[model samples]
Target: MPRRSGGLRSGTHYKLRIKSRDKGAHNIAKQLQDFKKEDIVMIRTIANCHSGMPNSRFLGKQGKIVGKKGRCYAVSVLDGSKAKIVVAHPVHLQKLGGLAVQISKTNEGVV
Candidate 1:
């Protein structure tokens, strides 16, 4: 037997399937959503679209938008003790709240 090796979405058949209730035409609003630098966003993979899709490991992880590359946005996420950047489309990202407050609070006690 041989071990398998591949990038992010190597074995995500069931993990990224769309539910019945969510089955329908894609939302134009979501496809056209815009994100600014420093915005906190949660990665939500769109199963059908693979262009600019981040790794499945990063799915549901919150990251800060750093900049834009072509039509995709560069996002910085903390993976374990290291920081990593991934390029993803807006359709796979959902805005999240309270990140600024949380960051500030975490920094307050640090000398």
Candidate 2:
């Protein structure tokens, strides 16, 4: 058997750090943000909240909101030519343009 090595977030020490002043301060509004279907959203990781985070490589990638999964949202993004859905918490999603988008129906699920 092969020995286990690095974990999924092994090299993301800097990518997941919160500012000193913002440490331990939870943004209640963001944590309870509401995202509508077809809206555009950006994936930004919140170090304080470790739940439902997408892959680090997907950080800063923008995608369309497909649906909701529990308290998280389903975001559809393009990985090369293939489309991928990344499920993340609302705190990690920043709505783009602060407006709802009108698009076709999408598969109702999150990663």
Candidate 3:
């Protein structure tokens, strides 16, 4: 017998399931969203969309838009003390307007 290896989507059953009411075609508007650098965005997995989805660990985390890679945006998120860049599609991200946005605005001149 061999030990099983876990893959990216192996344990993401609950983290990536779509709701009953929202299980149809994906919204085009979401796919067309644009994020400028410093904008804060929340990572939300849309189970139906796997093309440009980020890792499951990044789900529910907020990150700042650093740049764009191909059709996805590079989001800078702090995992513990280290910062990691997560490239994700716009459909899996929801723009947030709150203290996170203010923090990014204030730190604009620091870096």
lDDT of 2: 0.81
Please report the TM-score between candidate 2 and the true structure.
0.80
Our model 3 lands, by Cα RMSD against the true structure, at 2.4
Instruction: For each candidate in the order shown, give its overall lDDT on alpha carbons.
Output: 0.81, 0.81, 0.87
The per-candidate count of clashes, in order, stands at 0, 0, 0
Decide which is better by lDDT, 1 or 3. Answer: 3
Q: Give the clash total for candidate 1.
A: 0
Best by lDDT: 3
Candidate 2 lDDT tens digits, 69-102: 9998999987765689999999899987733333
Candidate 1, residues 30-53, lDDT tens digits: the string is: 889998887878889988777788
Model 3 TM: 0.88
Kindly list the per-residue Cα lDDT of model 3 for residues 1-111, writing each as its tens digit. 998879989888888888899999999999999889878899998989888999999999887889999999999887766789999999999999978778767765432
lDDT of 3: 0.87
**How do all models score by TM-score?**
0.82, 0.80, 0.88
Over 4 Å off, model 1: 2-8, 99-111
In candidate 2, where is summed lDDT lowest over 10 consecutive residues?
Answer: 102-111
lDDT, model 3, position 46: 93
